[model samples]
Target chain A: MDDKLMLMIPGPTPVPERVLQAMAKHPIGHRSADFSAIFAEVTENLKWLHQTKNDLLILAGSGTAAMEAGIINFLSTGDKVLVGTNGKFGERWGKVCAAYNLDVQYITAEWGKPLDPNEFKQALEADTAKDIKAVIITHSETSTGVINDLPTINQYIKAHGALSIVDTVTSLGACSVPIDEWGLDVVASGSQKGYMIPPGLGFVSVSEKAWKAYETANLPKFYFDLGPYRKNAAKNTTPFTPAINLIFALHAALGMMKQEGLETLFARHDRLRSATRAAVKAMGLPLFGPDECASPAVTAVMPTGVEAEKIRSIMRKKFDIALAGGQDSLKGKIFRIGHLGFVTDRDLLTAIAALEATLQELGHTGATPGAGVAAAGEVLNR
Target chain B: MDDKLMLMIPGPTPVPERVLQAMAKHPIGHRSADFSAIFAEVTENLKWLHQTKNDLLILAGSGTAAMEAGIINFLSTGDKVLVGTNGKFGERWGKVCAAYNLDVQYITAEWGKPLDPNEFKQALEADTAKDIKAVIITHSETSTGVINDLPTINQYIKAHGALSIVDTVTSLGACSVPIDEWGLDVVASGSQKGYMIPPGLGFVSVSEKAWKAYETANLPKFYFDLGPYRKNAAKNTTPFTPAINLIFALHAALGMMKQEGLETLFARHDRLRSATRAAVKAMGLPLFGPDECASPAVTAVMPTGVEAEKIRSIMRKKFDIALAGGQDSLKGKIFRIGHLGFVTDRDLLTAIAALEATLQELGHTGATPGAGVAAAGEVLNR
Candidate 1:
């Protein structure tokens, strides 16, 4: 049981053996020509994944680091930016903007609810002076299992001529972002979520409009400075020492992702999301968020009979499947099941069956013992 | 030839098989209690490695990010600081300060020379008004392979009542830093150099004095912010999603380092440094820095008659060994041989013998065929 633990968390998700094997190889010099080839190839494939030809840069840090870089690199002190706050990550962007002395205007929604695009539209329309320099939105809120209407909100930002800084940490690989089609400006994500790799690397895609903002943006930055990254990226290298083994892991994982193709990747996540939602519904447990705004990355469940922490403990200790507990205000009220990255239909079914058993062990009078798996099977088979 | 490549670079020095195996294991959730145990163990071992009981923080970033965090967390805009500039990394710290709009007064030294402690002493003594807030020093200049006199220079900072922010990237594991005895305020390092791991994770050890400074320091930072790191570290966790696999590698590597003991680790590096220098000297290659200030991590050589790049190329193609070329202005004039981390006496002797063969193949008439290895053998055997 020492090595049999399964990861069902949103981040630090399950990685493939091939990816781990690639990462286990001895690291070559980061500055070597061979490393450059890998860098160039990774950069190209990253653009393909994002569905954008924007300048994609990699940094050795977390999603927070990437999102911080996304905001700080394009705005100066007192630059008015609209930040959407519904979940933990959205509020995080607001905090990042505040830390840099940006004037943050918040468009709020209750927890487990998506941000209403009409509010963003009204805000942008009322800003007749166009004081709003950027609109920051988290596409897939990992905390509450809510995916905001990024496309609709981004339309208003484009109409207002403001750059869009998006957090696609949980949405990029799980769903279709289509950066070029959506005209998203600055999109940030991390390796642990949808990249099917371990944490440590952050990816940011910058549009030309965002680069224009960077030209005049004044923030005290060195490590997260985007200019040097862009300059070094032109030569197919990083300005700082990269995590060489992680890059190797990325190279292998991206190769696998490419072989799977984008449609299949997104379709698999869609099926898993539906199956998870359907299975939870059949088990008589309350799903936290509305079905219309469910995230493909994770499902948040607010069960009435079984305690959230108890469910997570049993799932982890007995089933060896690690599920995520709620963060912040939602703690002890909800538990999350991550079906992101390297997860398959079989994994979803296994987790649902375990959950059904956990409910039974907790003495909950559910519909039936096998009903959860049957519901999940209905969606997965479809 | 494919998988037989040997790394002789300062950073990303050869990783141990056990460490790589540990990293290859499945990643667990960072927020899980199991990961918290690993985090606690790694933190304790990091403090032991630094010879300090100060708060040691691990971050998922590169060394530049760690050093930048070390600087930005304790000082505000226009805070006067003296930055030592002798080589690439020293100048890099200065650039970080400049980016943060610090009033930087640099202590002078040539590229391959150690920073003169007297210059710092004189400057600190002359600052009667105590305008200087902190003194930034790089303990080992990786570019020029020169080790600065941190103890002597830090005395001036102490007398001047200014905090010391030190970059111990190359010096931490190669030699004894003894942060507590030295009263160093903020010391930053990376995992790839002396930890016998690949890059991606950075470590920063902060003294109580630096924490007091942090309460008043106002620099806009979110990802590199030390306040949250300290707060989280107290709970045996990180502020952000950590590089879980890299942390596993660090766990394995630091365990090995502890088994070897501090004295043995430093002695091994010292022995390799001496042997590398002797071998380079015997092969008619001019050592770039003086013996008194030689860094135990890497040795730079300015070859005569035989070209520097040519030697590196042949060493790579023929022996499948990689050596670091000089950076910036020193490029094309010198090549560096790294004896840092997992390198042993046999690796040094092997590299020397390969160099002799390379010199002979290049038709250089300066020395006998086996003199280089002979000189290295004497030091290694001693």
Candidate 2:
């Protein structure tokens, strides 16, 4: 293990010192006026980060809780839903929905591939009764480092009259989600990924349609019930005790984001992605995702005949650089290098240089040690 | 809201700088060996903090998630369970169970009251077929600032061949839980409370009996399935991506706890509780819980006819001290002052002084200024 390795994984991404300072503060009373103010600011900031004016509820859980909350609160027993499956998170949505007894129709796509909008349209047309209550899709699938086309998917959901629940756990704060413009009903995100905070808090922004559904929907929930969360969230208090420290971190992270401005943040991510992608290509490695749909948050590299885990382990133990490996079925096929929030061009260069060394150590010929670093530097300079 | 108010809420106590620093450190790769080592340390430390050698799973949610995970994973829908509803957390157990469609039979006690062993026996007698899968109880209810008698309740669950799930959210590190020795089948706790960190992490330690039921029992779960958690927890990894930065805080917090020694930590809480209770009694104000069952974590003071929220607000805005007010049914009746983890005798004294000032500001002439503080000092000094 690299004792001083920097994390370039999708998330728990790098956190700024100020956010950590905010988290380190004493745990305030969740119901107290002080905390209520912090909570309110955080909720508002989360909405701002998503670029939406929807009522956002914070859950003291991982992004999965927000996803589960979106599912359980929207559907009752035997509800049918269409889940776009292309990566781990999308499959997880199906698994979570199945657990709730929801009849989920899986819309499959190959790993590192985007689901066709036409397929979704056909599926919706087939279900003339509109029995499908919600359309679940991931904005940025971290597993394959692919950004799905949400605007097209949401349009399809709109035509079909289904609630659109988008998992922006990796997209928010890293890329443009444009919650309102995209017509997303429910958008879920986590603090650790792009918000530059630790994990443990999940944010869900609910549109008016979803909020109205929350009022009447009953699926047996207390802690994760959206009704209480929505009602209490307006006043800047959670229905239950939140992870107060994380809220503080959120407050700090949002302040940092607000200062940087969303447009600048998006541009920064774009530049970093371009640089990383260029570096990988210069190293003569195959890129996992299509160039058009490649995620700015992370880049997936395919090294022929290489086990993804070994490369990641070597990156960690040798040069103290940590990267993410493929999940489930994609195991040993692709290794991901993240360039999300709090990541810099310098970080990208360091990762490429380390990868070059690790590749050489693994006897992968035809790769110059400095080629990747120089390519990354050129893009970063541009 | 006071800009620099000190929080005296139990569970979300003050965090030390080192813990915050640990949390603020740049994010690490969650899947890498470096993180795995940190994860392993936290898992081992959680076992130590929980005082159990059983299966311990760390979750990225509040104590409620841990509580829900234990119940939903071990009990199938329509299964019956006995819940002890002495305070808020116990009521939450009943609420969450009902949410999951559990046929819950709760032995109720008034808020601020503790459950009697005889009442538990009667509930067990009512379930003659041994149909009760588990008995859910709270070791410390943060709302009412009362500690339940876990030893007595566990004895009942054991005699009846039912698993015992204890919510130690506010009591785990503050007092002696002794999970294995006390016959607790499932023990749930959160980091913000006794672990002396900011919120966002819930932990559960499961015994053999709970695991056995978890294998066959079916309840809706995805983010909080104890099965996957148990399976992955063995390798110092969570089933899902955890609140990684919070784990960093937890590592620091647990390190501090270990340095203090569990015995010393418990004694500190005991001393603080004794001081606060003695001071409250010395002031001649009516206290909420029974004298014997008063939690060392917090002290609920009933200021009859003196509006609780008003005084709490004054305390926050003027004296820069934040205390907890009553919830829904108990609102305006009492205000709770917490003196749990990370709090010192000086902090208790400061809180007492602030309470006196707020009471005076609210025109409460019942108690003398500094009287409680002075009395508290005597107890703490002893």
Candidate 3:
């Protein structure tokens, strides 16, 4: 009967009980005025979370769909674009752009390293013809636990007179990402990461500059068309039949976030991230990303002696805990501890305790029995 | 506490309580073994429901996205395609194809009229060079209660040496659609319509011939790419982070459908559609579409003396019943009564009674107070 597993992945984080209950309510007609009011309220709250007065549209898909919409809606075929890649998600943006026959100029950094703004600046400066239409960046690279310096990179994009498109999938609500203040032209995010809801809805905030670009952009789009979305959003509705139950869940989850307040929520995520990092360091494991730019949403740890998959398997089989393993090239080298969305300090302590037990069972007993929990507790107290 | 509204729309249909409870469970990691098992089970059940051994991939979006996927995956730019349009969803397919720069040859029919297979044959025979690459049709036009004859049209397509793409959004679980036997190349459907789940997930079944076409098709795609989906589906996973909670809900809903059996499910829908049509006739309202080609999922009624919107308003405001209004050119002229998915005879009777009373309130005194319900009951008894 004890089949409950704690989800600690980066995107599909733990959903609150209230939010789940809201989703379980009876289905409502998407065209009804009642549903339109609920949609309007959720849209306004999402704008508040993004700190943007720009147009925010809700799409029914993963974050990748939102990212694709941002690209296809504002750029035409054969248009030159600059893409910065330091992790898996960043590389995905480059691939999406390339899929539409866009001339992509990629500035890639090694995994686990923060993206340098100077690289983008140099690329932008080299475009003497001013042919580059947009500059794309990822705010939080979930694969390697590095938070790119969006503020600096966006400034370079602005100086070069190119539109700024940012992927805030893992950082929208987990930290302070002011889209308006940063002058981000198009920012895309997902629901399951920081909205404390299940995965279905993707969101995008569009600036006035991006909308103007959309008028001339002709890269072939239908389902992900922003024009229809913009027209319907003014009436508090979506162009297509949206994920209605997910929208209900989002309304409830956004209310909970409003009650907790954005400042308090960001501080809470920061505290949990600090505790997770402290616990990992105390366990004698090396952190993957740089100490200065660690992501508040998830912490990546490099297990020295044991394979990361083995540790994850042991944790799941023994303690019913689900942790995300490294993706792509970093597969057996690193494991991630996600503290995003509805995570608490106690949950982090429990995960750390499970990690300690799992490490001991693997015959890698460098740290004390309760060292990880103790370190996390010290950080919580501070 | 008495705010429970019955959803009678063609989509976002009434979700079963069991499916809702399944969706209320905590989120799971998309890459974990637990999710893979659920996903594999759901995929197999979907294949059974589709009556096809073809590769069926689930995308996280509305049915429109699946329709777009069917077009963009199997045809390149400027490819000639024949589109059959009788209603809103059919025209949507033509619009989607045109958006991608396809040379669309549309065979148009009046609203509420069934699409003629002879027209398609004529169109195909005229293309002496066999230039047409695909033939697209909507199996169930939700905007009008007309189920186009797909089996016959697909035969014409096969004889013409062209691929056939079908949109069965509101027909898959409501009636029999043997994709393999019908020789359908691509079939797309949505979750909310007949899967007894909420909106979000879109399913597309691709035949082997379509796979061959995909190798040479040059249309642009990223998030809706079927290549990665086929590669990852072999391992019981999706290419991107799917709508995890909706997949869980679909798993439970498909199990319920399996228990009910396809024969019984089709009979149930048939019975509901018959009773609904009888009730509307008893209430002195004319049916919109031809009686022989009426959809088993929903029934469209044409009011004689009163406006359709007035009746829908009265039903909603007084009885807390939400009926679907007409779309596009049929607005305020026809109201649809949906009996798809988890609907029952009792629900149909209640809706009929509400309609009768609303008609009386609107000063239409031709029918008795309980005439609609009585007629429906007699049909159910037979």
Candidate 4:
């Protein structure tokens, strides 16, 4: 019972025992040939996972740090940039832009709604003068479990000759984000979400266009400076001291990911998403976001008969299952169940069964016993 | 021979097994109450190690990131600051200042020499206009194994009414910084050094004075922003997803350090430094920095009859020991032996004995066969 706290949150996902053991290995000097060999291999594997031919750099920070670096490195001050906001993460990117005194243009929607790609297209077309330098979008809004149409938005960015900066934090591993095909200029993600590792390391991929913009970008930066990272990365090194053991964990996790293959990995996540959503709906809980735009990483549930906090509390205290509550304004309104990163069909069924038992125990007349598990099993079987 | 690599580098120091095992534990949601409890405990212990009652914040970054945050969070653009440079890290702070458009004044010294406390005194005394907003100093220059006279230099900064922003990256846990006693405003370090953990977490301790400066200081930051971190720390949370596993490692390592007690911790480092210095001296290798200014964390040896890189290569290849070679202009001229963190007296003796064998094997006449080990033993035994 002590170490059995099942994580059903979007990030800080379950890690495999192999990856955990890899992290426990003694750290070697970052400058050594042994480390360089591992670093080079890990970098290549990360590129494979990201589906990018661009320079994928790793930083010793969270997803926010990677997102901030993506925003700051490729644009100068006062440059007009369109930022999409629907959730906490999307809105935070706008704040990052404003912090650097960028001329921010927001394209916002309701918290649980996805950003309209048409809004981006319209704003980008209006910038015929080409003053707009970049477009910041969150691919998956973690707070609301809404996945934005980044592919369509990025196409507009390409047409407008503006860099596309995206936070694919939760979407990167759970869904297909073919960076090269989409022509996304910048894509940022964190380790905990999809890498199947612990937090602390962030990954960022930069296309040629983003690197070109780097030449003229006038933002003042040091630790998050991408140029040195690119140069050092070429030599199979990092500009700063990296999280050594975390890198080891990533190396092992990426190896596992490569074995799973991208197609299977994405398919697994898609199935997990369907299963989690199906289970929640069968319990008579309203899904916070619509099916069309729901994230493949996590499913947000808005219970009618039961309290969201109560469900989370019971899940945690009774079943030892940790569910994430809504962040920001959505607080206590919805509870999110994450089935991303190292989660399996069996794990989804287990979570669903526990949820049904909890609902029944709470005397929720709308929900039937075993209905949630049956619904999840149907999706998993399919 | 495969997994037998021993790290004797300045960073990525030897991590204790307890810490590594702690890091290998499954990561929980950072927002969870369980995580919050661990975070609060970790924060308290971190303050104990920092020897400060100030607001100590941790970032998922390297030491450079911590130092940059310390610089940017307390000063505005074009704020006059004096930076001391005797080695690589010292020079990096100046570059960080320049990147931020800070009007920087330099206090310079040779790489192998300690910073003249009088130089800081002279600069502070000359600034009758109080134009200098802060003074950045590296307490232990990791690149050169030189420890600057921080106490003496800090007094001058106090006299000048300028904030003392110090980089204690390689010195914090190795020796006493006594942040409050010295009235130091900002002190930054990394987990890879004296914290006895594998890299990734950077820590910055801020005094009330630095927080006061934070009200007006604006350098345009997001991820490295310390205010939100301060606010979150009060609630036992971080502004963003932290390096969860690394925090676990820190928690374990801190517990060990607490058990050992601060006095023993500092004394152990002191003994290691003396033993390493004595061994290198008896081996007829010139110490890169003078004895009075040598760092407790690492020892740089300038061999007379052996190539530094060659020594490092042979040690790494044949004996599985990883030693650090000189950086920048001093490259290939010096090799450094780290004696910080989880390093023990026996480890030091093993390294010195191995070095003696290496010298003999390399046909170096400058060093006697058994002199290094004997010398190290004499000092270590005392």
Q: Which ten residues in a row have the lowest lDDT in candidate 4 chain A?
A: A361-370
lDDT: which candidate is best? 1
Sorting all predicted structures by DockQ, with the top scorer first, yields 4, 1, 3, 2
Residue pairs in collision within model 4: none
Please say which candidate is ahead in lDDT: 2 or 4: 4
Candidate 3 scores an fnat of 0.95
Pick by DockQ: 1 or 2, better one: 1
The DockQ value obtained for model 3 is 0.91
Which residue runs does candidate 4 get wrong by more than 4 Å? none
Candidate 1 residue lDDT tens string, A1-382:
6788988889989999999999999999999999999999999999999999999999999999999999999999999999999999999999999899999999999999999999999999999999999999999999999999999999999999999999999999999999999999999999998999999999999999999999999987889998999999999999999989999999999999999999999999999999999999999999999999999999999999789999999999899999999999999999999999999998999999999999999988967888999999999889
Model 4's number of clashes is: 0
lDDT of 3 by residue, A1-382 (tens): 2557998879799999999999999889999999999999999999999999999999999999999998899999999999999999999999999899999988999999999989988988888789999999999999999999999988889999999988999999999999898889999999999999999999999999999999999999999999999899999999999999999999999999999999999999999988999888889889998778999999999988878989999988889888889899998899998899999888988999999999999988667878999999999999
Q: What is the lDDT of residue B335 in candidate 3?
A: 94
* Higher-ranked by TM-score: 1 or 2: 1
TM of chain B, each? 0.99, 0.96, 0.98, 0.99
* Candidate 3 wrong stretches, greater than 4 Å: none
The Cα error of candidate 3 at residue B299, in Å, is: 0.8
Residue range B338-376, candidate 2, lDDT tens digits: 888889888888888777777777777777777888899
